[model samples]
Target: MSANTLRAECATPGTQHVETGHRVATRSAVLRYPSLTTTVPKEFVHRASVAEVMLTDWERREDHRFVVTAQWPRSHSFFTTANGCHDPLIAAETLRQAGSLLAHAEYGVPLGHHFLMWDLSLTVLPEHLSVGDAPAALDIDVVCSDIKTRRGSLAGFRYATVMRRAGHVVATGGASFTCVAPHVYQRLRAHRLSGAGAQLPLTAPTAPQDVGRVSPTDVVLSPIGQRDRWQLRVDTRHPVLFEHPVDHIPGMMLLEAARQATVATLGEGVTPLSVIAEFSRYAELDAPCVIEARRLPRTEHEEAVEVTGHQDGEQVVRSTVTAAASAG
Candidate 1:
């Protein structure tokens, strides 16, 4: 492959299975070619890939662990907080991009294919919920062993990632993904609806600060008659969220809506430190998806928020967002 084309896998799955984390150290026999640099072109990447967390330098020293490096740029969608800490989502995306890209390089994951986030749980240790802009020098060691194949064409796997600065723990989380190749994705459902431009019934939008978005247009859902509830605004033209059309509501849009709700309820200054979300069904664009967020008690230094979306009376999206106490 050319320099920018692809990097084929050359390493073998070594026999040495060492305990890299708190979990038992049984390595996965199914996993092959443990490490690889990401080769997915920037354009093919679903998200705006320019400032994303794609892996560069990669090396696998053990069956359960691979050491790789990724960076979040200043132009990152979620900018650094005033305290100079990177968003927890950045760390989450780091784990995601690393694994997906590695899968593409090592397992011949098709270029047009993409992995959908089914379940994700990430937590920041500190009370402030801020993982400082740990530079590119810091390498995130990922341990992956849980890989299961579906009956048809799907594959499910979970990854455990840890981020640190100067050997100090910054954040940790484990997330599960469902792989959806291009052919499989196209077969699922059709993209967009009949009236793409018709206006939907919606309450006036609250300010960007109310939803934690830097700009009002960034907010995907608008307020409803009920408090702490919103009607998902289906706009295919959204540059960042909806770069292209899709059959269902994009997972990132749900995450962003939940994040905005959590921040809106928490009010200003608080930042989303960690979030755990589960997608049960597709929030179709043809109908209205009612979003509701409930604030949990201040259990830890950081407060908690629960957001859910209902479509046709069935729960489609659910998220538990934890925000650190606002910095002064």
Candidate 2:
């Protein structure tokens, strides 16, 4: 195989050869060599809009190891901080896109397959995230491990990433997700496949400053009567969060809710620097999901908050967010 070649084999019985140009997949196998280009296909990242795709290009270094490149604008409409630094969640989004791209473009997972993220974690240095005069070019070194395959198709994998800017380490993160074929996904989401009429009434969000956010539209938690608790607000009309329609709440929205809940619990002047999250099940949009945050035993330099989301008496997401005082 060549440096850019990706080999895929079809093991299913009675399957005939399917050819696309020079590539063919029969009961045997085939090889595909991606052209070297900076433009990443939006479908590889599972994004509806090309503008939302973070990855610019990727190259396989060796088996299970790859290098992915991305570009972060000097200013983003949503992923910015009032403290003049970039939001740490940007790392999370980049990590998510990088993994999805690798799975589809490298591992031979079809484009129509669905991904179920089991867990995600990211840690960033505050000073490293400060917006520079120009857009930041990032190179991410990714190592995929514990790969699972079935019927010669990728089932799932866990990957770790280290992001660098100008040779300086900016962020480190990892995530694990499983892939489901189209038919299996349809069976899994039988009745709730469509997003039509699945959204509930919009509730009023808390003050933007209270949650360390500048825009009310970006806040994902609505204040309730109880302290350290809020209702997860679902805004299907939001341009970025709900870029395209889906039947359930987006994982990024849940992550934002967790960040807001932590900020609210820890008071102002603190910015989240690390986040570790686990998703047990999908958060349906039609039901009310309650978000709660409680302070954990403080460390010397950081404060931790455990944020949980409960829908219909079942926990859907649990995240531990660690924050530190913003750099002056």
Candidate 3:
């Protein structure tokens, strides 16, 4: 078969014509060609937003390694920021996406939530690539080095991601992920699926420390509604509970918990859309703080909420969240 025909057959999932069982799945298929040479639509390119840099048409050899290319658009929103990265969550999700691709390709099963990310070590290199800069393209590569399993469960996988502009490395990071069972994976999986991913179930809110409480707070607040705004206070004793020895709470976990708390305080049913947050200062494990959310304008599709985290009357993190109305 011609090279084009071979690539086409390989890109098609569940196609009988492909000899190797290792077919490219939905997310991984983007990496099959050198710089997006495949016939996928341009819309997928746009939807990826900041990830367009890493979803190139780079050729993949039989060794399971791939290279993708992207250009840092000068007009992109992240260019003017301190880190110059729009969202840390996107970085985390990119690692997760890479891990999912590796897991499916190596183990023949989709990755799920049974495993959580315990740690991530990231280094944004000094090199900065601007949109209008002479070198317009960036190189992104992901590779898995070690995978461990225990008791028939996915213990974790260690992988590295490198981001480069014009052949120069701009950012690099390593991630670790634990795996869970297929059923548990399904619930989390449903969120990404169509129709199912539309809205999260609005149940009574629970605090991180409420597990041991004989009577937990059952107040189900609407995080978004006609109300003007919502406010939250995240007070904790010195030596905050579950504070990691690393001096920083896991960014993703803490952000999610804070989002939940904001939603609970709003007293209006709201489904979280996206949050762009920055970790300005570290909160003392024992230090108590306040997180406040103010409702902003609303569009037909989403409502905007502004959030801020403060400790000892000083701001630590600030975020603006967009959420959809709850299904109920």
Question: TM-score: which candidate is best?
Answer: 2
User: 77, model 2: CA deviation in Å?
Assistant: 1.3
Worst 10 residues of 3 by lDDT: 235-244
Give all candidate RMSDs, comma-separated: 11.9, 9.8, 16.6
Q: Which stretches of candidate 1 lie over 4 Å from their true place?
A: 1-40, 43-53, 77-80, 125-137, 150-154, 190-204, 325-328
lDDT score for residue 252 of model 2:
93
Residue pairs clashing in model 1 are none
- For all predicted structures, in order, the TM-scores are 0.74, 0.87, 0.40
- Candidate number achieving the greatest lDDT relative to the actual structure: 2
Report the lDDT of model 3 for residue 167: 71
Q: All candidates' lDDT scores?
A: 0.67, 0.87, 0.45
Evaluated against the true structure, the overall lDDT of model 3 is 0.45
Over the full model, what C-alpha lDDT does candidate 1 score relative to the true structure?
Answer: 0.67
Ranking by TM-score: 2, 1, 3
